[model samples]
Target: MTMSAHGRPLRGLADLRTLTGRSDTQIPAHKAYLRISFLELEKARRMQEIRTANDRFAVVNARFREIDAEIADILASLNGTAPRAHALEAPHRSAVGLRPVKRQFQISY
Candidate 1:
């Protein structure tokens, strides 16, 4: 069931007949193959979609961590001797802080 890069498309039994030249004898096999190939191709497409989404998420997570670290360093440098309340307003706040997060974890709504 190998396909050429620019091979003829078998849109249906008639199209398959034109491409293979001996369509009558192989009609049953061709029909079965069409069904199986369509299903298999669909499954593979879905798997690829999932892999792409996973890669995107990984990129997002890495970016988020990078931004978080950069902001933490900036905060530590700017307010080393400031009062706790002033520093609390920074993004890299204490463990219980509620600073607004950066757009490093964004998706289009």
Candidate 2:
């Protein structure tokens, strides 16, 4: 027997009809099974999408790190110093030893 993603035996509408013999009592059960199967399929698709998005994010992050290294090399050359490769090894730190600064303004009444 073939199993569905929801762990139920795979059955077509015709198979369900033939098995249930159009009995009213069994109709609801079949409907419930179909609904659950649909929900499980949708959840699996969404989980795959999330996994793809995470992979893309990781690739973009790696490229950004490469760009940071290139910038550091350029800056070091400009400053007449050898690039300090160790300085940029910290994952949380960027090419420059500075964090983004936020400014606040005061409003006058």
Candidate 3:
């Protein structure tokens, strides 16, 4: 089965139903309340999905940084420079890297 961004498979309906407190219930719930509860559950699911994606992104970004540092170390050795002790130090150390982008909106008649 395919895995989710959270490193686990998507939860089955039983798991979702359990979270919604409807898994073991025998009596039927009102249609209106059921609909509202489902909507809220969906919202929670979406939030979890976004959180998982962000977590995955963070892991991938960290791996990329490690790879980049290793490559830089190799390049330094090739150039006959001193072996970089702190090879993982960011290139733009203590630099403000963020710049605001100005957007122009044009309206045509």
Candidate 4:
């Protein structure tokens, strides 16, 4: 192998001949071919990864939106139920079990 100037791979003369059992004549042509193919493969892999991430984001976003709408509708129903409170009437914290029905939601009379 050639004595490299720095602590890099012996990417020259005798190294190439030993690596593939071919001579220096073949090294340039072989490296050029590998560079072209590797570039194309790298581009294809990146595009595939981007597509998979987008698909996952779409699914998660749809589920989030659905849950938000459900919560909004439930709160709206609670707001629509009353304009006052009494011993026989209450707010939804009791209805939804946050507070106890037996105790009443508030000291409404």
What is candidate 2's lDDT per residue for 1-109, written digit by digit as tens? 6677899776776664454444465558878999999999999999999999999999999999999999988887789665556654546745687756687667889
Pick by TM-score: 2 or 4, better one: 2
The total number of steric clashes, by the backbone 3 Å criterion, in model 4 comes to 0
* Candidate 3 lDDT tens digits, 35-107: 8899999999999999999999999999999999999989887887555676575666554886676877779
In model 3, the runs with Cα more than 4 Å from the true position are: 1-29, 80-109
Q: Mark the regions of model 1 whose C-alpha exceeds 4 Å error after superposition.
A: 1-29, 82-109
lDDT of 2: 0.82
Candidate 4's residue-wise lDDT over 1-109, tens digit each? 6766896865556554344554565558878999999999999999999999999999999999999999999988898775576576554453554654586457756
| Candidates' C-alpha lDDT | 0.82, 0.82, 0.82, 0.81
lDDT of 1: 0.82
Give the C-alpha miss distance for residue 27 in model 3, angstroms.
19
Worst-scoring 10-residue span by lDDT in model 3: 16-25
lDDT of 1 by residue, 2-109 (tens): 776789654665544344445465558878999999999999999999999999999999999999999999888987776566444546646666768766876887
Q: TM per model?
A: 0.46, 0.48, 0.44, 0.47
Clashes of each: 0, 0, 0, 0
